[model samples]
Target: MKWLKFKILILIILMLQVEAKADGIYFGGGFYSLSAEVGNKSTSLSNPSAYSLSYTKSFFPQISFEIGYSFLFESLIGGDMSYGPQIGVRYYHYGTSTNSTASLEGLSIHEVKSYNPYLSAGFSQKEFQSIKSSYSGFYLGGGVEMGWKKNLSLFSDFKYSQLSGPVQGKANELTIIVGIIYHDF
Candidate 1:
């Protein structure tokens, strides 16, 4: 009886370990570079370094939702500054495979050993330090995520945004980001 109980305990522990690889909530932090162009000029108005923090929920195999905040401040004297909230959707292309549909019932951590790419689109509201006013915008971006360890992943993203209120002609913004995310296990 003692040996049988020990075997059952070991089996339960194995099951719990298997459950740890499932995808769910994620928290991420990253740094980005921002540049803006006015009118049809190829020259950039300002190039600033910024940072962001985000929360993400992977609801299904192909869909995930994210909300993030980014801040850009050049100096304490307020040379140029911008801060905003980004809400976006990520669509994952799992590709075609014989077992793809069955495996996607829940994506396992091992599935990300290869580079997983996704496209994202969202809305943002930014507060500009120069004008002391808020502006809303729309952005489109794409990124790739690479699995690192048990519950950590690295990602790189590039985004382009068009703001409603233009500083000079029409402000077109571009941003590139690199970050790490921790997944719920």
Candidate 2:
């Protein structure tokens, strides 16, 4: 009976000890580094470092909708290299703000006062010089968001980007990026 009472007290203490960060739409920009392989050859690109601007809006404290656009000089350009568009979802949890595996580890959501961890999944399409030889694919990734201030957040994402077979058998592009996110609306 004593043990049960103690357990309940501990649970309540933890619940009350959580902190509130931000839990709404997060729109911002950052740089991306992409690498991929083409048949027997492999390539990597850091500069001409493309720009990715995004909007992350949340309906609930745990879930949100995200829309973003980015431009890059794909590792290998069979024809023309250009930027692409991406659309997807982002789910966040502020209960784990100190985790190193967070997507937005350096950002904060001031809607509540608790954990600061999150996961995101999205898709992107890469347009090349030739329509018949384009590259596009979907990805699933997750991480946490930490608060540097009230509006600044440092984030990292690991994406597995593959080329669509409809666009021909092109090499696959899997990328990971770490950048800053600033909240606007």
Per-residue CA lDDT of model 2 for 93-165, tens digit only, reads 6433231111122332233222355677778887655434556778676655655555566666655565563
| Candidate 1 ranges beyond 4 A from true positions | 1-43, 46-48, 75-79, 95-112, 166-169
For candidate 1, write residues 1-185 as lDDT tens digits: 99766666665554433423334333333434444454565434444366667776666656778788877656422467788899988887852110111122232223344577888899987887876767678999988777676567777777778876555634566677777766643
* TM-score of candidate 2 to 2 decimals: 0.58
What does the lDDT read for residue 143 in candidate 2?
A: 53
Question: In model 1, how large is the Cα lDDT of residue 141?
Answer: 93
Q: Could you tell me every candidate's TM-score relative to the true structure? A: 0.66, 0.58
* Model 2 score (lDDT): 0.54
